[model samples]
Target: MAEFLQFAFSGLTVGAVYALVALGFTLIYNASDVVNFAQGDFVMIGGMSTVFLYATGVPLPLAAIIAILTAVIVGLLLHRLAIEPARGASPVTLIIITIGASMFIRGVAQIVFDKQFHQLPAFSGDRPIEILGATLLPQSLWVLGGGLAVFVALWLFLERTLIGKAVLATAANRLGARLVGINTAVILAIAFGVSASIGALAGVLATPITLTRFDLGTIMTLKGFAAAMLGGMGSPLGAVVGGLLLGLIEAFGAGYISSVYKDGFSFIAILVVLFVMPRGLFGGRSVERV
Candidate 1:
């Protein structure tokens, strides 16, 4: 039971980060119909920037805020420079552009941050709390709490705010939204900025536990993409559930099977989901008239 509890706690900790990443994907996908592969780069930017800034004598809290802002700026630039210009392009073209953007961001990050793995000092401390012979790091609590808080805040923003409704309208139908006086271009830009912020927050919260480097976002992108697909690409709630489920699968697989193949399990999950349920667990069915 203790062993199980240990794995469960570990799963939830990492799952929270995956959930944040998945949320970023969902947000951008809904608003722009573009899957920002660079989502994970935002995470890397957040973590690496915080580490670099803190090392240069900046306070940790302030450094994190600055890092998030930096990602938001990058996101806005991505939209203005790349996405906006290519607005009428095909979906595949837009996807390739995002891929190129991801590569560009990674190359820039490598130049800016160097090729070193870095970790932040835990927000709380190094002490671990014991429960039923299982130990839980205080940082885990921060990750979990942060993820939940972001979700609730996002829900409120979407449900109660006028701008949020505009975003929703734009997502539902771009032409219709434009007819209704919603500035879809602005909504798309906001989506990118907000998504980048969420990704950065995930990096800030998870970096202490996962350690980070310039290339860290690559694998995180794949994992987060898988989580998004598993939960239904455009569904926010599905993103969270898929992320947590993927994390739990990884934890249990590593605990019971083999740690070496832990990453493989996520790929396997992706394959299974693709073959068995292409629409994802929570994805809605689509119908087309011939």
Candidate 2:
């Protein structure tokens, strides 16, 4: 029972990061109907950039701010360069371009950060707290809280603000949004900024626990994509649940099953889910529509 609780604790901590990354996917998908494969690099940028800043003697808060801002800039540029021009192209073209962007970012990161693994100082020290037989680090609480905060902020933004409504309107009907004078171009830029910032924030929070490397984003992106797909591509709520579910599966799989196969374990279940449900738990019946 203790081990199970421990597993849950670890899963939730890591799951928080996954959920945030997944939320990034949802944001871009909802706004532009594009899956930014380079999204994971935003997380990498946050961790790597912050680590470098801290190494250069910058304060942690300042480092975090710069890191997240950098991610937003990168995301905006990727959209302007790779995605925007290819808007009239086929979906396959968009996917390839983003994938290329992802590779380019990874290569640049390796050259810049030298493929080293790095961790940040915990926000409130490294002490562990006991909760119902489970021990968790103070940083984990921050990560979890940060994830929840992002979700709530996104929910409120989408559900309340006029800009948020414009974004939704563009997603629902680009022609209609254009007719109504919504600047879809600007909204796409904002979506990229918000999505990348969220991914970067996740990196900042989870770096202490998972550690950070240039290559880390690839797997994190894949896992996040899986979680987003598992929930429903465009559903923010689904991202959270799917991430938590994946984390729990990985935890128990590592414990009772085999740690070696723990990563692959999620895929086995994903395949099963794909076969059984096709669309996913939160996903609509079909994904053909915009």
- What are the candidates' C-alpha RMSDs? 1.5, 1.9
What lDDT tens digits, residue by residue, belong to model 1 across residues 1-290? 99999999999899889989999998888786788899999999999999999999999999999999999999999999999999878868988998899999999998998999999999999899999999999999999998898888877877899998788778778899999888888999999999999999999999999999999889888889989999999888888888998898899999999999999997798789878888898886667576
lDDT of 1: 0.91
Question: What total of clashing residue pairs does each candidate reach?
Answer: 0, 0
The C-alpha TM-scores of every prediction are 0.96, 0.95
**lDDT tens digits, residue span 1-290, model 2:** 77889998888888888899999999988887778788788999999999999999999999999999999999999989888887667657887798899999999999988877898889999879987887999998999999999999998888899998888888888999999999888998899999999999999999988899998888888999988888878888988888878888888888888999988888887788778877676876555644
Cα error, residue 206 of model 1, in Å, equals 0.6
Per-model CA lDDT versus the true structure: 0.91, 0.88
